[model samples]
Target: MSFDPAQALRLAHDTLDIEAAAVLGLKRRLGDDFARAVALVLGITGRVVVMGMGKSGHVGRKIAATLASTGTPAFFVHPAEASHGDLGMIQPRDAVLAVSNSGEVDELTVLLPLVKRLGVPLLAMTGHPQSTLARHADVVLDSGVEKEACPLNLAPTASTTAQLALGDALAVALLDARGFRAEDFARSHPGGALGRRLLTRVSDIMRSGDAVPRVLPGADFSHLMREMTRKGLGASAIADADGRVLGIFTDGDLRRLVETGRDLRALTAREVMHAAPRTIAADALAAEAAEVMEKHRITVLLATGADGRLTGALNSNDLMRAKVI
Candidate 1:
């Protein structure tokens, strides 16, 4: 059959409309039963054991990940596998969350009695509140939808959308109840961009010790240039004997000086530096350093110790490499 472009576009729009309605319908039906599910999971000492079959299993896996990342301990256990041996993965302290639009999939229903025997609370996310799964559940969450988004009204389209939205709502409510913070989320996602921004400190990414370009006030222009060249910082800090930053001189300053057409041989670090250069606390967040650099329209920033002494130096490249910006 030839593809009709206009028909395909219309179907896409209709599918989205149907799915959106299914999710919105859940908001109206949400009440005491939803609250009970959240409270039951919160009171549990062990993880939430999620299980399902086929398409529902796919959504169950995603829900488990969302729950685990948002401060709730959870994992997905395939229902068919439970009969073989995976049932051991579920403990007495854990709560079982089963997802099924029909709520009577044999593989899942077969395990319900065993889950109950283990004294694990069963939370049902199903369209049929009176189905076997819901009948066995300690808390029944109504994931019912008017119809599937498929053209034949048979596929698990709108039903899955409703399940996913309901799962998200539960995770959000639980996270808020637990007071889960962004810093806590960063700990769970150390390799992600948000993690780098929240957990990386200026000192962690800045060049410190011998890598920091610096020269004393009495140093000649040649010495200052050599320090900048060796460190490749494109700039050098002019410091007192105790390593307290007194000034900063950059390549831009050198260019301006050369434009003057004056003799540069007599210049010392103190004679050519900009005094009281902008600095950030060594312990400041790398994200905060990025904010400062963006606000000042500068690439390099000096990191200072408590005594206002030079601790380290960082540039835009350093922050980019750290994935903190």
Candidate 2:
């Protein structure tokens, strides 16, 4: 009934303003309590148990994932379930980070006494420092916001964004303190592409043995073409009797030879092969293989051993299918 563009634009601007204020306000709130919270979490021998309800619960799960992936080792435990037997998930060596906008989530408050009784250090992320949960917590992280992004100011919008950002800050700070590296991140994300790039070696993805396309220096251009086609790498490795790579002949070489009016039927592998082709080690990372492909501007690469012998071969298409790209 009412489709005013002006109203829509006004609401969008209001949403941006609210969220921006919430994030900007975060700088002024970073105090001794935030430092103490980080220190407690860093010192804990057990995992960090993150707890929250509703929107806060979503933020809590993400915080836990970030912490775990960054080497802090954390996981989420819903406050409602904690009131049942899930509180047992919190061990003595563990630290707790509970999130609630009002600082008085019923489920969280119910487990506060039990958590305190277990001697677990409690860290509260909340808008109200004077509220019950904050008063009970050993450390309170201020996530107060001036307003909500919703026009009526009833929905949890800006508050949840502020909480999520604050959680990220905590996770990053701890990650830096522990000297967590990209290798550590890769370890936690082995199933992801980034993890594959950082962790999977060329040896793990290259075609070896009978799958490799190779030819001797005496082989004719026809043999090279057949080898390249059979191997499907768009190239054939030129190797010695001992399997040591000497050079490489690719589809590009075939084109160049044809353009030069050279007779393919009369040309030898040695006449058309690139004398020194770019190659990578089988033990090198697949990420490095991708980089090599970019550097050489080629579709295929020969994998060599430390002895300079051809061990395997890989191509851009192989990397794509492996999701290394």
Candidate 3:
């Protein structure tokens, strides 16, 4: 058998086209029912419990995460597990989002009566509106597709794509409705890079105390060089006796000084420093610090307290190390 790259590429494009069309179809079908489902989930005082089996379960897990991260508290519970002992996880105040393309999965349908008995709101995402799950649902979201991206139409491809897209749509709508901000999302995702960018403050990652490169205004060039080398921040803050930042002397300043062939030994810190350099507030977001650094075309910034005292220092490398850049 010969491997044909062109044929493989054509098949891949066809598969993508099928999935894309399925997602587009969902947008046309979205209407009052979609709005009702969003409302049902929003009105619930408890978590959104997502349940499914097999591939649907995989999609359910992602949908649960997206909902949870976007301000709707949610989690995925396998339908098979729910029948054994996990059913107890469901509360009357919670809303259940059941995913089953056919909406006829016995594991899920068997629990519908109990779900209804508990007076829990049931939202169904399925291909068949007349299926058992949808019949019992308080709100039904149509996730049906004309066909699967699979060549044989057996694999859950286009159907799963539609389901995932619809789930995202629901989450985004609820997120907007609840005014879920990036900070709120960051709070939920504190361990990720997005969290570091949104939630981390300058004081959290900046070097403080004796580690911050500093020199007295009257300090000699030798003293400045030692401070820059010891701190390894490529810059030194020129501060007064009260720890008030007066100016910044960076490596760039040093390069310019050498360009003039000036006697390095005769210069003082105040004589070469750039006065009133860009400073960021200690409590400001690390993301804001990155923006300030980028705007001024500088690599380092001196973090200042409310009274304008040099509290800490950070550079592009520090921001990168903290995953804020």
Error of 1 at 257 (Å): 1.6
Query: CA lDDT, every prediction?
Result: 0.94, 0.91, 0.96
Query: The CA-based lDDT of model 1 is what?
Result: 0.94
RMSD per prediction, one decimal? 0.9, 1.7, 1.8
lDDT of 3 by residue, 119-200 (tens): 9999999999999999999999999999999999999999999999999999999999999998898899999998898899
lDDT of 3 at 132: 98
TM-score of 1: 0.98
The best candidate by lDDT is 3
Compose the digit string of candidate 2's lDDT tens values, residues 141-247.
99999999998998999999999999999999899999999988998999997798899999988999989999999998788888989988888999999988889
Question: What are the runs in model 1 whose C-alpha is more than 4 Å off?
Answer: none
Runs off by more than 4 Å, candidate 3: 1-6
lDDT-wise, the better of 2 and 3 is 3
Comparing candidate 1 with candidate 2, which one achieves the higher lDDT?
1
TM-score on alpha carbons, each prediction = 0.98, 0.94, 0.94
Query: lDDT score of model 2?
Result: 0.91
Clash list (residue pairs), candidate 2? none
- Per TM-score, the best of the predicted structures is 1
What is residue 265's positional error in candidate 2, in angstroms? Answer: 3.8
